[model samples]
Target: MTDITDAAKRLLLGKPMSSERLGHTLLPKRLALPIFASDALSSVAYAPDEILLTLALAGVAGTIWTPWVGLAVVLVLVVVVASYRQNVHAYPSGGGDYEVVTENLGKNAGLAVASALLVDYVLTVAVSISSASQYVASVFPALRGSEVIVAISVVVFLTFMNLRGVKESGKAFAIPVYMFMGAIGLMAMFGFFQYLTGSLGEAESAGFVLTTSEAYDQGLVGLGGALLFARAFASGCAALTGVEAISNGVPSFKRPKSRNAATTLLMLGTISASMLTVILLLAMETGVKYAENPAEQLRTVSGGAIPDDYVQHPVISQLAEVIFSGAPWLFMLVSAVTGLILMLAANTAFNGFPILGSILARDGYLPRQMHTRGDRLAFSNGIMTLATGAIVLIWVFDAQVTKLIQLYIVGVFISFTLSQLGMVRHWTGKLRKASDPRERSSMRRSRVINVIGFLLTGTVLIVVLITKFTHGAWITLLIMALLFLLMRSIRKHYDSVIEELALGDDLAAARALPSRVHAIVLVSRIHKPTMRAVSYARATRPSVLEAVTVGVDENEIATLQAEWQKMDVPVPLRVLNSPFREITRPVLSYVRSVRRQSPRDLVVVYVPEYVVGHWWEQLLHNQSAIRLKSRLLFTPGVVVSSVPWQLSSSQGHGVETTYFPQSGQPPAMEDRKR
Candidate 1:
């Protein structure tokens, strides 16, 4: 069974590589761009839709400001990218936001950043994959209602690919990512070229009139409009979700890791900014209309409602239809790659989350298992964990990107604001110690950039919380707060355990020998297993030894005594009465009595257990012995030892018998011979 499972694993993940091969897995700049920047770049596919959707509430008058909102988003993206470049250079250990905040702001502040980033990474996968499924469904209308299933399937696929190793996944994803870039770049250039030549046509949704909601009938005129614009801006800032991934993944790059990572960050910011600008510009120019409910929010010029079956395509799809109308194949190609890139964007989170989880685990905030590398040298446990989280969110949200977007960006901005604030502190501390003139000037410049970054991101964070809190952002904040408390509790536990296990000047006293050793063998009947336990107890050469059992029935006790006399057992047997047929409590009471009789004695309880081969056989045997062993383990100065008698069915399963010493020293050679 084990061999079959291992074969399946090898088929899926390939053979295990040696730890020395880790360096060989380092990504080059070309590969790292796609691996770490896909999320930020793919935001182009959905960020514009979110911006337009939020504005559609105020009707067409509000939608005209889409370009300005996108530019605002781009500005924040630029500052965040620049700020994180400093982070990667200064803290190349790949701690990213959590490390920066922890070192500069303190542990509690750092934990806050960690909690936010962790929640953000999960949402990144959920939102990205869910949007990708939308694109897929748009192209294949038959799959429209099954987006949740499709998104989950894609997540599973990506998880397995990542488990194969980071570099391997990077190589596989590089082509599709570059193809997406080319497709979008070509579409943008074609759209602009057609616009310059006075040949670009309006989108299919252009003829429809967007009706304003009653709350915004005045349209971009007062306090309500201002709040709506801020909401739009906050929604557009989804473009910045994946910027910190580059900083979190610095160690994955080749030699000169920090420089490569920073370069990638610059490239990501440029490409994402350019893509977002072009998409939004073309969306507005071509008169693309997207709404939360198109059937209700859209109307004809005569003030009549549109058809109930009308499907409001995403902004990019509408733009593609208008820009690439002449070349149907080009439109399909763009749509396919857009979907592919959105799905691949989750790769950024997959790369970032595991590394950050490992850092948290190393710091004793998460389970220690999260810190270990798997067979493929990936944080396989963290990858699986992130996938599970994303899957749950996808299932619960029904893969609705619009609803999920309301919950997005809040956590990223929290991390962003705190990270930039930490960078400011980091550079300030550096400036005080730097006496060199050139270094001081550089530190001062970096400080200025981070300060601006902090201001912009902090404002955006506030806007996000205010505009989105009632719209689903509160769910994210609640999760982050819960995670923060959970991590703090875990750290406290780890610290308490460390304090308890710390050896002091009384080490010799802790290791002092007991005055006497008392051995007890638990028996059910005079069988080979019981005799084996008795023989092992006698070999221990304790000061006192006895065989004990629970007498549930008088007839059974009499039969056991007859068999014991027939076998001429050397050890005296004592039976404890149990009117209720309770096995564990009586054994525990007897062990305590023995300990009370000799206060300074060590009691070793030898339990006879049946070793079975198949899993089902376990349910049929060793039921009483298992319960008694668990109870005996907590008694003071008591040791529970198991003497296994392998059944006939257990043979040919590679099972072996070995002796283990309870003491801290190796057993004598004579014991080994026995």
Candidate 2:
């Protein structure tokens, strides 16, 4: 049975490769773009909506200002892209924002950036999946209530695809990503043409009059109007959420990694900015409007209320419906592509989160497992963790994109603002040392660009906090705080472990030979396992060796002694009486007594353990051995060894037990008794 299980595991995981093969999984620029830039590119789908939705709060008057707001957002996006291109070129080691801030702004600033990016990555998954669910529900009305489940399912599916390998998954993602770009681009072009020809019409919901809530009904007359516009601009800044992903993934690119990554960033910025501008322009031309609660905000000509069940499609959905009025298939195609792109947006988190986790893990800010790549050369554990967290968020929030969007862009902008500030410092430091006139000029120009980026993003961050903090950004901040604490705790633990393992002043003296070596074989019964354990212990040639057993019953104790004598065992057996049937206590007491007798000696306790054929067999045996080993581990100057007895049920069937070693060390099975 053990053989069969081992074989099954081998078949499932495949053969292990040398660590050197990890480089084979590295991605080229083409693959890296889709792998890491999907989020930023996909943001064009909903960033326009967020902008328009925020403006919709002011009624038709506010909607007219969307183009100006979009242009401002586009400018920020362009500046941010230019700033990050410099970053990718300057710090292409994949340290990204964390590295930049750490190098220039000090460690605490770097940690803050790390914490923000970590939280942002989580929100990226949650928001993208939730938005995808909304798109799915828009296309198929029957899936309305099941959005959470559908969103979670998509996250899980993307997690597996990423776990397979970055290169493989990138190939799969390229087509849909490009198709999404093409479809949206085509829609924008057609909408632009229609507007030129004076043929554009209002969306299906555009006929309904909007009843602005009391908070935003006032015209642009006072400070409140300016604040409202700031809020709208803040929401529009969601377009910049995924811009830093390329910098974080620079190392994943092939030859000239930095240049390729910079190029990819340029492409991502251009495509995303262009697409977003066109989408917003077309939405306004087509008179598309989206309301958080349509039934409440919308009224008919006769003042009749729209039904609660009325499905108000997303801005993109409504625009698609108008653009493809005659060709139903085109609308469905666009809808399908939009949903697919949103889901693929989760792939950006899939790639970035694990890589960032690995970097943090290497810095001792995360569990060590996060630093280790899997069979597919991906951070499998980190990927699964991201997927699980996303699924939980999706379920908890009921996969409502509008609700999740409020918690989105804030964390990302926090990281972006800090990162750009760090870059400004970075270029400033470089300029001081740069002797070459041309290089100094270039560095100064880069510094100016980053300074502008820092100012713009920092202002947006403040706006987001003011506008969104009370709404749901507080929850995001709470999550970031929790994650920051978690990372600090992990770092502390690793530091403590390192300190404990460090060589000390007494190292030479501690390494000196023990005055004596005392060995004992723990036996539960007079059986082959016990006999083999005794034999193995005697082979160690300790100063003293003996077999010890805890006698819980008088009859069994006498029978064991009789059988031991009758069998003429090579080692003498010593039995301890357990009045309370406490196996570990009795064994520990006897070992402590031996240690007290010879304080300078080392006590080696050999535990006779059974190798189980199945998981259930573990419960049937070795309970005392496990308890004994646990207690012995904490004892000073003591070495606990397990002498396993492989049962007939555990052997034979060509099992490969060599791959996964026990406890991250080489398997000690070779020292065990057959």
Candidate 3:
């Protein structure tokens, strides 16, 4: 069963990649763009809708702020992208925010950034997959309420693709990303032309009168109203969610790594901002309206409430329908590309999470398995972890993009603020050391840009916290705090182990030798394995040698004793009685007594174990031998060795066999000849 499972996994995930081939997987800029930028680019799909939905809580009257909110998000996106371009250029080691914060702010601050980025990566998958499922549901109404299941399945599919390798995933994602850009870009262009010509028609929701719920029925009137406007802006900042991914993936780029990474970051910023602005503009031109509770808040021209089953589609879907008005196929194409890009957007997290995780692992903050590349030279462990987290979040939130979005940008902005602060410090330090005039000017210029970025993102971070805390962002902060404590504890553990094992002043401890050697061979019966272990242990020429076996049955012990005498074995056969029919305990007791008798001597326990070819055959024998060795290992002044005798069933298998000098053969062969 184990073998089959392993084989199936290999077939699904492909064969393991060798360490030498990692360099071969480096991504060119075109492919790198999609792998690292898809998350940011795809956020355009939902960011505008988020802005409109939040504003619509005050009825259609409050929805006029959509353009201004999108502008604020776009401005912030540009500064962040510019700031991270410097990051990719300066610290192209793929540590991203963690390395920058650590180098400038200190270890604790760096861990804070690391925790935030880790959380962001997880939320990226959850939000992107959930949003993608929403688009899928928009296209196929039959799958409407099954959003959580669909989101989880897509996460699994993306996880499988990423496990295949970075380069492979990038290739697969590039087409949809570009297609999405072309489709949306053309739709935006056409929608704008029609708006300019005064020929554009109103959206389907243009006629519906939105009545603000009782909670906000007064509509944009005081300090409470002002905070509501700011909250909408904060939510719209979801457009900036993936700007840091390029910095985290700098090392994955091909030749001129830093430059390619910086260029990619620039492209990501431009494309995402463009798409976001266009979508919001088109939604306005098409008069697209949304409501928090469509069944209640939405009313027809005659003032009747819409049915509970009325499905309110997203802003982009509504715009696509108007832009491709007569061409149904093109509308379907728009939806397909939107859904495809959103699903693949999780690929950005797949790329960034593993690289950052590998860096964290190297620093001893996470498990070492995260540091190793998988069969395809990707961080498979980290990929699986991100997928698992996303699956849980999708299930919990029931695949609602709005709920996930509240938790999404908090970590990302936290990272953005810290990373920008680090860059400011980085530039200031460089400025202090520079003697050349041109270099000094460059440093000062970079410092100014970083300072602007720090201020913008820091404000956004505060806004996100104050505006979104009660709405689910607090959960993200709590998880980050817990992760911070856990990482610090792991670092403390690794540090303590290093300090204890340093061996700085004690050379004698390293060269200590045993005063004497006492070797014992463990046996179940006078079989080939037992004889082989006895032969191998005797070759060591210890001060003492004995063959020990537990007598679980008297008749078997008698037969073994008779055969031992008949064979005239060179060593003494000492049988121990197991009153409880226990194998490991009695042997442990005997070894401890021997050590008690001779404190300075080393007792080497040789355990005879069978080697089998097939997985099922492993259970047929030597199960007790494995347990005996494990217990013996912790005993003071003891060494345990396994002497494996290959059974005839092992032929043609790849389990390595080493022939020890003159280990015994099965005595049954000699008996048969007699």
| Candidate 1 ranges with C-alpha deviation above 4 Å | 655-674
Give the range of the ten consecutive residues with the poorest summed lDDT in model 3: 665-674
Model 2: lDDT of residue 388: 83
Worst 10 residues of 2 by lDDT: 658-667
- Every candidate's lDDT: 0.91, 0.84, 0.86
Q: In candidate 1, what are the lDDT values of residues 1-674, reduced to their tens digit? A: 65677899999999999999999899999999999999999999999999999999999999988988998999898888888888999999899999999999999999999999999999999999999998998889999899999999999999999999999999999999999999999998999999999999999899899999998999988999999999999999999989989888988999899999999999999999999999999988898888888888889889899987888877888888889998888888888899999999999999999999999999999999999999999999999999999999999999999899999999999889999999999999898899999999999999999999999999999999999999999999999999999999999999999998888779898798999988888888877777767767777678888888899999999999888878888788899999999888898998999889888999988888887878899999999888887778788889988887778877756446654434323333443454
* lDDT score for residue 175 of model 2: 91
Q: How accurate is candidate 2 locally (lDDT)?
A: 0.84
CA lDDT, candidate 1, residue 141: 94
Q: Which regions in candidate 3 have their CA more than 4 angstroms from the true location?
A: 1-11, 14-17, 613-620, 647-650, 655-674
Model 2, range 197-249, lDDT digits (tens) per residue?
A: 98877888877777776777775447877877887788778788788888888
lDDT of 1 at 249: 91
The whole-model C-alpha lDDT of candidate 1 against the native structure comes to: 0.91
TM-score of candidate 1 on Cα atoms, chains taken together: 0.96
Candidate 2 collision pairs: none
- Model 3 CA lDDT for position 494: 91
- The prediction achieving the highest TM-score against the true structure is 1
